[model samples]
Target: MSEADLIYTETLMQRGKESYTGKEIVILGGGDGGLLWELLKEKPKQVTMLE
Candidate 1:
């Protein structure tokens, strides 16, 4: 998917926002992580890439 076309499933988005909250999130897969990394920039303390 293109950078602008990436979409997170509802559950993933909810969990990311709720459970993950302010914790660093480690993304296991690389495909979607790029886009996630960008979206997460707003909440820098809430996301990280592993692959």
Candidate 2:
């Protein structure tokens, strides 16, 4: 993963790796789909991206 992806997917959430676990996530304006890709690794309940 890229540095920005790491930051947004992990560091920015401030809960580390388990941040997205079983959670519903919505991503706004992630046109490149990088954030979606990284977030999926955490196994969130659902992920919706609008771009």
Candidate 3:
């Protein structure tokens, strides 16, 4: 990941726990499945990626 991507991921980490924890998350346009992998680290109820 690029520096900007890392920064953005860090930002998400800050907000993810409150918003995504234990919630079903659907990611649209996630062809590479990167977002799905990232979110899975948070231990959500479920995570789905659609391309």
TM-score leader:
2
Candidate 1: segments with Cα more than 4 A from true spot: 1-7, 15-21, 34-46
lDDT of 2 by residue, 1-51 (tens): 678666765554565545788999998988677778878888999999899
TM-score per candidate, chains pooled: 0.42, 0.69, 0.63
lDDT of 3 by residue, 2-27 (tens): 77776676575565446677988877
Query: lDDT for each of the candidates?
Result: 0.54, 0.77, 0.70
Which model scores highest in lDDT? Answer: 2
Each prediction's RMSD over C-alphas, in Å, is 4.1, 2.5, 2.6
For each predicted model, how many residue pairs clash, with residues at least 3 apart or on different chains?
0, 0, 0
Q: What would you estimate as the lDDT of candidate 3?
A: 0.70
Residue pairs in candidate 3 whose N, alpha carbon or C atoms collide under 3 angstroms: none
Off by over 4 Å in 2: 1-18
lDDT of 1 at 35: 49
